[model samples]
Target: MKKSLVAALAVFSLVNAEQISIGGTSFERVDALKAYEVGCASNDADACFEAGWIHYQRQNLNKAIELYTRACNANNYKACTNLGALYFSGEGVKVDIKKAKELFSKACELGDGDGCNNTAFLYEQKKDIKTALKLYKKACDLGHQIACGAYKELSK
Candidate 1:
């Protein structure tokens, strides 16, 4: 049993190795999804986010959303922001501005400047200038340059 486990791990490691190119030749890329899945299974939120990004890049929106949600639940604010953007844009799922706002708020509370900025934009679109200003200010305080500019503009 131990030998079988060792063999399996060795095979897995080989599969996850970076592809090599020699003398102007190229090799097929490693299976990033499998590697990420292993990482995510170990509770690595960043790996889950990376997997989601790969899926997004491949236009596999549903899979991206699933992975992003998992990372977000693990307190990965960037993943929350990404998932919120998908909800806001109705990409791969029905439009859910309310859900997007909730996710953005969660991410902002977790100290994601971009999430705060996004939430502020949503509030601005809803004609809630007061909330927008507050959120923009929060984002600015978090060192978001664009949010600082918006805060300055709104304060003027």
Candidate 2:
């Protein structure tokens, strides 16, 4: 009966236990931010990206930018794309289309479809239809559905 009771409690706990693993440590959902932060501090690229995303969702853009920069430097494509998006949208930082283009271009070269799509957007904004069309096609080929639609529209 004691064993059964212990097993029942364990099951109950697991029902509410969403876990995030960082650096071989498992953290519960409520502790995910701290876990990611710890991992980021240890120079884990994926952890930095996760922490950056959490900070962004929490409206802590400066922290997000810092963490994202670290991850981006480590060649985390998602981090580069996300940082580029922040610069592109002027969210929490002044709009810097130049920086956005550089970051997005880097991510595209790293094979992220969103990066290609975003780079195409910057070119489109500059009225460089030919460049934008080429990038949009590349983005579409890379599996960004939105870019496919944009490419179709531009083709017309």
- What TM-score does candidate 2 get on C-alpha atoms? 0.79
User: Which runs of model 2 end up more than 4 angstroms from their true locations?
Assistant: 1-27
Query: Which digits, one per residue and each the tens of the lDDT, describe model 2 over residues 9-117?
Result: 3333332446644445454544666656666777778778988987897799999999999999989899999999999899988999999999999999999999999
Clashing pairs in 2: none
User: Which of the numbered candidates is closest to the native, going by highest lDDT?
Assistant: 2
Residues 2-81, model 1: lDDT tens digits: 22332233345544345533234332234545556666767778768877887897799999999999999999999999
Q: How displaced is residue 71 in candidate 2, in Å? A: 0.8
Q: Each candidate's TM vs. the true structure?
A: 0.80, 0.79
Q: What clash count does candidate 2 reach? A: 0
The per-model lDDT (C-alpha) reads 0.82, 0.83
The alpha-carbon lDDT assigned to residue 89 of candidate 2 equals 90
